[model samples]
Target: MSDRPDDTPAPRDADELNEAVSDLGETDTDRLEAVRGRNESLEERLPGDEQLPRTHGSPEKG
Candidate 1:
């Protein structure tokens, strides 16, 4: 007389876990693109969007 429903989604099996790990292995490009985009936007907001002023004689023997 058990009335428990069994429509719940099945837990991820070994194959699914392996595939998930494989997918994570190939997501570097997307991550890099997002970081580059954020960096450009932040540079635009700063006072000097081009480059910081170079220090004079800070590092000799160049």
Candidate 2:
């Protein structure tokens, strides 16, 4: 048996997936909120909280 429990929710079928989509609401604000949340999560996963400066047209690194 797997160590983790199967308590996680799953889309049993297409109908369930459709229902979830409707429940989630396909709005622009919702999409922006989701993207912001994802960006926050990715930033948190970065090496440090420092924001590096942009170095466009710079020399290639070795």
Best by TM-score: 2
Candidate 2 displacement at residue 12 in angstroms: 31
Q: In each prediction, how many residue pairs overlap at the backbone (N, C-alpha, C within less than 3 A)?
A: 0, 0
| Per-residue alpha-carbon lDDT of candidate 2 for residues 12-60, written as tens digits (9 for 90 to 100) | 7988755655644488578668768888999888865246554566866
Question: How do the residues 34-57 of candidate 1 rate in per-residue lDDT, one tens digit apiece?
Answer: 668888999778877336665664
Q: After TM-score superposition, what is the CA distance of residue 9 in candidate 2 from its true location, in Å?
A: 34
RMSD list, candidates in order: 16.1, 9.2
| lDDT, residue 44, candidate 2 | 84
User: Relative to the unseen true structure, what is the C-alpha lDDT of residue 16 in candidate 1, on a scale of 0 to 100?
Assistant: 92
Give the Å shift of residue 3 in candidate 1.
63
